[model samples]
Target: VALADLGRLPVTFATVDPVALIRNAVWANSRRAKAQSVSVEPGQLPSTTVLVKWDGARIEQLFTALIESSLRYTPAGGRIAL
Candidate 1:
């Protein structure tokens, strides 16, 4: 099933903002952050807009994985800056 879904994965194209994408990913994982006593901070996101065409869903998933992996080693009351 998972293998089949790989071929069907929705690939989308849109102008994506890196900062907003990071912020959205952090917001989406807020619950986990609270539970783990981990704080996610959005650092100096470039004031100059960054535009890239890509699959937003896949990017979100990537951020989720990255955050989750960080949570593994991050102690309580830790912070993650993007």
Candidate 2:
């Protein structure tokens, strides 16, 4: 569905917390990082939720892609704070 949306589909925008998204992205990619012995965790986050209007799925995909790319380059025993 996400791939199909790439064909100029209208973005489903809504209020979302970016910090929560970051944490979720970290969790989603943690297993791969563990397999490589690299620590993947969320950095310090704001105490209050930061809301924004955007396509949540696309934002998540972007975060996941960035983290996966980092995992590909980071050495074993390295740390990545998203």
Candidate 3:
């Protein structure tokens, strides 16, 4: 599952916007939160471009997995922060 989640990437790296990326990923999983009765919260991260040259999808998967992991360990009404 981890391998599939981090499926592919280009041979070359590119600058990435982590906030936007995580926002989209969280949005995509919003229904999961409702179903699990847990909240995945994001802090007030700045708009300052926190750029990084890395596997964007992998990084997103890493965070997404962390959130999901929290759901498993946390109580039904618990919260996971990013």
Give RMSD (Å) of candidate 1 vs. truth. Answer: 2.5
Tens-place lDDT digits, model 2, residues 18-41: 998899999999999999999998
Worst 10 residues of 2 by lDDT: 1-10
State, as a TM-score between 0 and 1, how close model 1 is to the true structure: 0.79
- Model with the higher TM-score, candidate 1 or 2: 2
**lDDT by residue (tens digit), candidate 3, 1-82:** 6545796534446788888778866776678987999887776778686788867777787788877777788888887778
Full ranking by TM-score:
2, 1, 3
Whole-model Cα lDDT of every candidate shown, in order: 0.82, 0.90, 0.76
- Candidate 1 lDDT over 1-82, as tens digits, reads 4844778766788888877788888998878988999997776788787688977777888888888888888899999876
* Backbone clashes (count) for model 1: 0
Q: For residue 59, give model 1's deviation from the true position in Å.
A: 0.6
